[model samples]
Target: MSRFIPLSVPNLKGKELEYVTKVVETEWVSTGGGYINEFEKNIAGYLKIEKGVACQSGTAGLHLALKLSGVKYGDEVIVPTLTFIAAVNPVRYLGAEPVFMDCDDTLNMDLDKLEEFCRKECTLTNDGLINNKTGKAIRTLVIVHIFGNMANMERLIDIAEEYKLKVVEDSTEALGTYSTEGRYKGKFAGTIGDFGVYSFNGNKIITTGGGGMLVAKDKNLIDKAKYLSTQAKDDELYYIHDEVGFNYRMTNLQAALGVAQLEQLEGFIKIKMENYNLYKEEIDKIEGISILDFNKNTRANHWFYSLLIDEEKYGLSRDELLNKLNENKIQTRPIWGLIHEQKPYRNNQAHKIEKANYYIDRILNIPCSTSLAKEEAKYVCDILRELER
Candidate 1:
């Protein structure tokens, strides 16, 4: 109880050091090395996907995905206002606009709203789905599997097909999440869409310090992504460039960490699932706070846990509880401010954001780190229980 319980932290007890030491000894610490290729292949194999391209970060992967999806200047991309800003910023990176959609109870894009927006507010043309208001093509749909919970992809995919929108699954927070039934049964979060991206940030279920992976249904596109990531070398020996490229390749050092971290990914997910159940069982019994649940049809990675608080019942506002938790040395954070309301995005179109607004004010993220001890979780619950009185 004396030590601060972080909201999320990397579980590096695996062979991270040994693998990184090997990379250091080999002197191939930059982008080109065996670790990079091994990490990409391992991730693609884990997801049961055809190929994966390693890159610098999830944001970079998204930018590349959008570019590969044919998003261009003056185009628009459908996105979720309830997700982290990284998911939306990539659209702007391509000089495209974003149409922010609301979130369902799962804190994922509301497929109902997305379908309605496409059917009622846009027109499908030979070019693609065109926004009635802007008259620009809606080229892509970026779906973020928020907090490792799979969005209703079965329904979303149909909507995209009908509207002619290319789908990009922003699976940054859902590395191991997958559907257990229906069409996408056994398909991992990042594998079901036209393109999918994974992050290896310090706080994710697995960590490569700072790196990401991109997967696509088409093998050729995967090859293109790799070329674009590594400076678009037309002829590597001559450094001939046929087009614009980015210095976004993942370093061998990071990939070494990723290879080791991935080996323990399933184990990390197991611990996360168990801890989530423990938190839910105890927290649900409290007067005004309860743990958020993932979709029933998917096996989520349980990356982060959400605590919904009712101010009238809990006798404290969400901010009040956040401050109290900080005072008690129990680290907690509020859900992200709706992206639509942020200063830079205030003018962007956000459709029917009722539930997202409601959830934003009530949701708090508590300590759910993979390294978190059971006793530490118990201590957190005890504090919340005591606060109820």
Candidate 2:
């Protein structure tokens, strides 16, 4: 047997120990410490956003972002069906409905259909406000930058602006991706949205055991987000509460880990991109395997290097290859099941989900972790190449 190859894992070679050790010595292991604030500052600095509120997890961040976006009972938020359910669950958390949108080959919202739905299926009321045909106010759009490849943010932003929709970005997979062209020139993925949320789950590019950050362009919105995360309390001498709040704040221990992860984010992104390139170069040459595409206008962190299998050409399906890869201890995964197809979201309106279904069976995410060496990446692709032929 050979060493097992992990799909993705944390890379902690930076200040994690030093910061955590200091917190332990100071006896401030929970939420009370400088590291929490320092970690917030570190991430804000790295992302160059107005502010970042660290929370219990990315799901919590999405919850806060939706709440802040004024997603209330019976509202509709347009969301991609091909995403981790966390991206859409927050909409449900607010008692809001998610109008499912389809994904293009880029694994992003299909703008053409998104626009078509807004124009044809929806009508502007006498108030000149667009509302869903179901008579619900379509209030927000939750755009996930899936697998570190950015959605077309500029066009998406334009559509949001036109529809009077608040945009909340699920940027959990796109920590270091940025655009170099169009209206999004020099813009990072999450920063362009009304509320940008990130995850530091254990398998993410960076990890704080489990944590999340919420960022926004407005300083007041960011402050309000922090307030909401801290339990919506007014100035408190005796824990006076104004509105319902959540204990969603990140702990000092998690922030200590975050500080360390922040210090090494750039290096981790470099390794991830290099590994993606290596996968593309080595695997794309095979007859029936195609490397996933990245948006050149923006550089993706290349979180997951996906291979789209030509099932017809190879006389095999993606699941067949997936099973074989698993048998060989080469971990690979299928893309997320479309959310609209799920039991919970079945009643929600879906627009043109054909493209999402197209890529769903074909896309297989390969290991492209920062911890993976060049040789290990080559070996994984070699397995795929052998399986292909």
Which tens-of-lDDT digit does each residue in 1-389 have in candidate 2? 29878788888888899988998999999867898899899888877775699999999999999998888897788899999999999888899889999888798889999989988888756433355568888878999998999999888888888878888999999999999899878788899989899999999999999999999878998899888888888976789888898999999999999988888888888998888888888876888888988998888888888788998786569999989888888888898888999999999889878889899889888887799989898888888777774
The TM-score between candidate 2 and the true structure equals 0.97
Clash tally, candidates in order: 0, 0
TM-score of 1: 0.99
Who wins the lDDT comparison? Answer: 1
Number of the predicted model whose TM-score against the real structure is largest: 1
Computed on alpha carbons, the lDDT of every model, listed in order, comes to 0.93, 0.87
lDDT of prediction 2: 0.87
List candidate 2 segments past 4 Å from native. Answer: 126-129
